[model samples]
Target: MTDELRTTMERVGERFNLGEYEIDAYLAVLEHGELTASEIAAETDIPQPRVYDTVRSLSDRGLVELRESRPMKIVAVDPGDAFGDIRSSLAEMVDELEARYTAPARDTEAVSLVKSRSTILRYLEEIVADAEYELALSLTPDLLRRFRDSLEERVAAGVSVELLVTPASRAPSPEEFDYESVATEARARRGITTPVIAVADGEYSIYATQDALRDDRDRYGVIFNRSALGFLVSGFYGTVLWTTAETLATDGESRPFPRTYASIRRAVKDVHELSGEFHVEVRGRDVATGNEIHLEGPVLAHEFDASEQVASFSVAGEDGDPVSVGGLVAALEDVEAQEIVLDRS
Candidate 1:
């Protein structure tokens, strides 16, 4: 046989092998068009005793046809004809398996340890997609790119996204990153030693050691789902990590209103930075009747917890009436705020 023909046969053998013996027996019949069990054993290295068993296996898989002649001849079914049914069967089986498959119930589990880098990445993507109101993430440059699409989707859906990337030099530039497309704000930390961290809606969080990205085989991460442990992760993120990071880009116009008193304090600080009068609107349900309430006016005064989870502020309404409001941070989940418009009039 020509080297080209041998190479082609070798490729085909590897691509569609049933087993070593089955491939040897099938290829022997293909070479001769048809071969009796003894002829196959003579042409291929398969033992005489094993050739018949190997041929029988190929026949069972519909890869070869068997004729019940005196020696039980094996016929090479055309590769096209042989694999077409196998391909169809595989496709149908995949569809059926997909239909029956249910995603694991991981959301309710308090804690999970994920060891595969790919699985950790998948969970990160899922956490971002599942967020409704808030997201906080610290990522390496590589992960930032991997999750860019998922982040953009959630931001477009009105989920607030705060992103921090480490080793500022490795991060994409603001122009290249297009921060407005994916995040409410993006910041950069000074060093590469930071762990990869993410919190979704301030409830679900993932914390991974830096090695998680260095070696896929050595990777590990922990997921906290609505567990009190999540609070520790978020606190470290907010107080230690986020506070020390330098801003890279921000979409002030698209920033969602502060939903918690803690977020309110952050908003107030931003207003304070402006050193000017600003119009503010606060929307929430009245604790008594659960009736929706809207308070809009120029900022008067504000008070909040050091943790920013509880707050009260006074606002002057359009009617020249002073209104005072106070509530837990959890109460602000239903609230929405427009960009603070400066009332220079």
Candidate 2:
């Protein structure tokens, strides 16, 4: 190989350092367009064991196509055509990611009402695990007891967990929930649960209601996710959470919680544009320490990006200016940081 060719090879490797193996394979195909693994090995002087690996990687990255012609050839894609495919693939990926993270429900009208217990449980698990922080739930004594182990795992992950148990559920003092049990379970797992709604981490809220939820395989569970209906369920049954063993533990007389209707007139304006989006609302850390801070929000209206290092962010604001998401994340991490000062362009 000539000096210029060597330099280009090095540059190709450098450019694709992040993507690694695939890009190297693509470069190999570019230099020797029609070659089998053995041909690639011989031309590139790569080890025999790695020849197949490189050829497969190149094919996987869509840089080279394998064919069954005269010599079992591998053809390199045209530069312009190859790049167009990559760009299109990335665009589709971003769309799918945004849908899962930003928009929870879509394209379900014709999928048949998924009312099966197994399906409901699976959906509930997906929604629950995706929660960024905090999970507010209301369940009877029977239900909580069943999910006790799972809740303990969530609480231990530095997540705030607040649960209210009605006094009437147990006549004889309800088995004091084991703190040791809580701690031990937490030690064995990685999870997080928030204390309550104090500037909640994630916007979407998940709730489940069942007379008796058990580990039994035969039983079915009903779990549904909805911002509009959840707002109502949570608002109306606020007492189920407020009347804890602590509140009624000291109340002059136990009383049933009154229905909540404070937010009855609230309207849920559809944020349709938010479909399939991931938003990182970067702020600053404490000014004194100059640490980094980052907050991720499920958003459709925001276009945001930040580098790995807490340097700066690029987000289009109401006015259309380039702002730094990483910079903002750092600013918010600072103790003195204030309202999300977005970079508006």
lDDT of each: 0.71, 0.39
Tens-place lDDT per residue, model 1, 1-345, is 446445545544544667788877887888889999889878889999998789888887677899998978889889889777556656655566577688888876788998877778887888888787678899999888888899999888777788999878898898777877878888899876788998876567899876886774447899998735676677678768887888899874545444332234345544544455666666655555666677777777665554444444567755777665543223433333312222321
lDDT of 1 at 30: 85
Model 2 residue 314 lDDT score: 43
The TM-score values for the models, in the order shown, are: 0.56, 0.29
lDDT of 2: 0.39
Where is model 1 poorest over a 10-residue stretch in terms of lDDT?
A: 336-345
lDDT of 1: 0.71
Angstrom error at residue 324, model 1: 12
The parts of candidate 1 lying over 4 Å away from their true place are 1-90, 253-345
Candidate 2's C-alpha runs over 4 A off are: 1-114, 171-175, 179-229, 239-345
